[model samples]
Target: MTKRIRRLTAALLAAALLAGCGGSDSGSNTASYDAVAEESLALASGGTESALLPDTATGESAQKIIYRADLYMESTDFDAAQDTLLDAVDAAGAWLEYSYQSGSAKEQDRRVEYTVRVPVENYSAFLEQAGQAGSVLNLSENAEDVTSEYIDVDARITSLEAQRDRLNELAAQAETTADLLEIENQLSNVQYQLESYTQQMRALEGKITYSTVDISLEEVAVLTPTGVTFGARLADAFGGGWRMFVDFVQGLVLTLVYLWPLLVIAAVVVGVVLVQRRKHPRPPKPPKPGKKAPAPPAQYGLPDAPAANAPPQSGKPDAPKNPDAPQDAPAAPAETPEPPKPKY
Candidate 1:
């Protein structure tokens, strides 16, 4: 009984080993845990080797990203900028892909553009250098991660290769020519699929290793009025000023022509004022200094003049009887003094 139990254990171990050998090739890229768990389950159930999907890869392989950039820029000198771009491309181990130019050198809006494929490691460096060649108007960059597609393609190729091996084995065992032909046809179809997958993977790898760049260049020159020189501008300023002065005089004359009736009314008013001033001229003011005026004649009906032969009164002059009377009105008479009061 002890020997029989030992033999049973050895047989079971041999079966598990055989299953591992069969699954190992298909599961080589799979995670270790999945492979181990699958093997254990197959061992317990006494099943044949199980083909596995790529284990849910918790850890990713190296990233595969296709990078692209677009740059738009203006240059002071298009020729020089183009030359600098080429040199920068070579320096960064990149290659020019395409270029185009529109318009003649004599045209103001002439444009030039370039495209390049730069090494992945040098992508940023090359981009910075390209921008330095001119004034960068716009820069855009994109990254497309091809890692999932890349892995899937790789996995598909692995599956196809395994299938091709089985087809080849079956072809080798064919007995008749018709059977061999059928197997060859199937093998050919499988080969074609594998080749297609391989080509796709190769393209993805190429793009991952090298990034693409598109640069558009334009030539710009400072713009001014038709005549650009300082001397021309100064001459224009002086001419404009003279023209403005002439326009001002013309406008003034035109305004007066349009308002002629109003102007005439104003002129007549001024003329009337001057005529009235002349017609009603005022008297001259008396002299201010040094003259004595004559006394008014007496109002008591006294003789304005003494008799020419009459003797003159001596001592003080006689006082007028009506001193406060208006010079032009006569006053009441007063009697003369009686002879001189009889002298006694």
Candidate 2:
């Protein structure tokens, strides 16, 4: 009985080994077949093996370029130019991402700016059409190539997706709770990385597909010349000076208009002052110093009056003293004159 059990055990072990070998071989064959199918699909789509592989020197793809432009222009008629710009944008099937306007019509300094997004196919045509909106003062264009970056991001995304799929498969096949949890954690990390790279790829594609244009539009009475000749420069200088002067005058007028209330108040104050002055006129000024007044005119024919107590004139003969005049010689002693009293 012991010998029979030993033989049976050996047979069971050999069967188990054969089954394991067969399963491994089948899995490898399936993997090889999938790889071949993928390669065939890539070839059918005009892609090479190198293109399917990352970090290979033989693969080449279309260039991914981001285009940007800046345009500064001036228009004689702001309304017309704005219409033209809108029409151009509509014709090009472009949209305005941003728009802003500054200054006012009264100042003749109205300005409008636009940020536009246009398809790559319509970039040149849109630029040409936009130039007609006004006389271009400045134009600049730039292009950035993102082919390498695009390829790198795409490859990384593909790698992360593959890693996530492998981790999911491992999680499903995991026998222990600990192994399953670890695989799930790894899968989550791979998923997060995939999402981030996918977003970057989409952003790159958007920039590559659409071109950006920054347009500045200014309202002006006259178009600036593009010439660099001495005469043109001189004319531009004079024109600029004239425009400045006109702007200053306009600003001054606007300032006055804004302060009309204050001006009215000042006028009312002045009127009140004048009315008060008229009601109470100032007194006349005093005579100036160092000027003497004229004396009163002399009488025409007035006789001279004799002085009181005057003696006989020296030139004329005197009358003899009479006896009555001798009575005054013995006049009593003259009394002292009394002091004058103070007057109220």
Candidate 3:
């Protein structure tokens, strides 16, 4: 009886070992537990097991999703087109984190730059609607594949998990605390490595799930009054110059008009002052009678009066020696007297 009980115990131990071997070898202990639970549930439900089963995955994977696009559209009114494009993005439940626009009416062109994010499932549908925002001029898109990297991370995670599990089993069979501590330390390192792999896989999956798109718009040139001909522009410039000249002439004339009255008043005052000065002319004093003028000297060409000191001329009876001259001849008187005496 003792030999039979020992045989039963050995056989049960072998069966448990085989079941654990069939579980996943992935670095994730959670995956291993899930497989074991699934098989146990299947057996309890009386489901027949298959002879051959596919090999289970025992690792994490990595992936990256990246792409770019270029789009073009046209519209008569720039503002309207811009509004419609914005509306489309909102309706698609997407967000544009960056955008820019610049252009001129002459060129009939406007450009926009956008960095956007949309739901992974809605990327294709949103792009189709965006195409109708205006006239489509050009379109191109591309995506990069990273399936190989995903499988690589999965394989690494599997190896780390198996190492960690083996260390746990060793620590359970340890004879002392020191031996158990050593095994635990190695297990910690393996678990940390496994966790690192998991984080990397999640990141890759996120990138592959999202897509990016870029778009541009072109404006149509239209006729407007602001776009005048060369001749019309020249005429406008000349008109401005003429207006300035006319204003300057009018200012000069106004100044002269204001000064005319002042000039007339000054002239009248000057004339009145000159007339008053002339009317009060000074009178001349009469000449006084001075000493009579001396008579003119005798003429040089005529005879002049004789001097007082001059002798008497011989033409007159000579007042001869006597002051008083006898009346007859004295000699004749003496001879007549002698003759009368003789006759008596």
Candidate 4:
């Protein structure tokens, strides 16, 4: 009986060892299968399987992508600066959407909007390049990883595609046109869902791949003024004002000076006219040649005075004047007396 008990104990030990070996083999096989599956799922080149399709996937996980950047630059040459900015964009493989100038001569501003395709690995490098375009005044950068949302959207797309394929197969099996129409309507609905998901995916992809860059450019002004200063400027302003005032006064004086000749001519003409008016304006007629002027009559029956320059006319004319009978003059004198005597 002791021998029998020992045999049974040995048999039990062997069975237990066999069971343990089987358990070990089963666990090893399961581990190997999981590893193979993980490797296969991680199909992307040079990437881990988990990176492509994460352990946890959902519809809302991979739908959001966030990226933004803003920078400022200064350059002396606007065109060259703009060219440099364009080159930077090209280097970054960005889309130039908008650019423009702002402000006046002294203060000018230039701004450019570029939608840059920032490779997930090269976002930092892209920003560095953009900053090298000019002197950076202000810079801002932001990023958000949407690995969860992306996984979610991908899973939803897979499910939707499977549903659509199934609907297509149902349409193909339809025996009647009405059945086909119903299947088609269901297919259409699936397709619409697929389209909506596709659009959302594309938008999410755009947000992930392309980061927005808002760049502002300012022209560097060399503070070198052409020797203009406070005192000099003030002097210039005062001098300018004084010159203007002088010019105005000179113009007035010149205007008055212009009338000087006219005033002089008028005064001369008036003086000459007045003098002529006061003098014999019309000349007197000349007297007749050799004609004597009438003499004044003797006053109160007095004998006429002798002319001062006359010759001594002789006594003869006075005696003939009436030494004879008529006292009035020699009258008919003697002849009259003789006639009277004859009558007696």
Q: Pick out the ten consecutive residues of candidate 2 with the lowest summed lDDT.
A: 15-24
Q: Write the per-residue lDDT of candidate 3 for residues 198-287, one digit (tens) a residue.
A: 787777676666566777776655312345689866875685587568668988899989998997999999999899889976676545
Q: On residues 96-141, what C-alpha lDDT tens digit does candidate 1 reach at each position?
A: 7788887558654567777798999999999989888887867999
Distance from true location, Cα of 64 in model 1, Å: 1.3
C-alpha lDDT of all candidate models, in order = 0.68, 0.70, 0.59, 0.57
Residue-level error in angstroms, candidate 1, position 282 = 99
lDDT (Cα, tens digit) per residue for candidate 2, span 1-344:
33332332233223222222321122234334334434543444334321332232215578889999999999989999999999989998999999999778987789899999999999999999999988998999999987766765665555455445545555566667766665565556656667777888899998999899999999987777776679877987897698789889989999999999999999999999999999999997765888776665768798665698878568768877887564645768889999999999
Residue pairs in clash, model 3? 26-58, 59-154, 60-154, 62-150
Which of the two, 1 or 2, has more lDDT? Answer: 2
Candidate with the greatest lDDT versus the true structure: 2
lDDT of candidate 4 over 22-112, digit per residue (tens): 2112223433433443344333222331332223222233345578788876666666777877787777667666666654444433334
> Which stretches of candidate 1 lie above 4 Å from their native place?
1-59, 223-344
**Every candidate's CA RMSD:** 26.4, 21.7, 35.3, 33.7
Q: Highest TM-score, which number?
A: 2
Q: Per model, how many backbone clashes are there? A: 0, 0, 4, 9
TM-score of each: 0.49, 0.53, 0.38, 0.43
What ranges in model 2 sit over 4 Å off? Answer: 1-58, 228-344
Off by over 4 Å in 4: 1-65, 103-118, 220-344
lDDT of 3 at 119: 60
Estimate the overall C-alpha local distance difference test score of candidate 3: 0.59
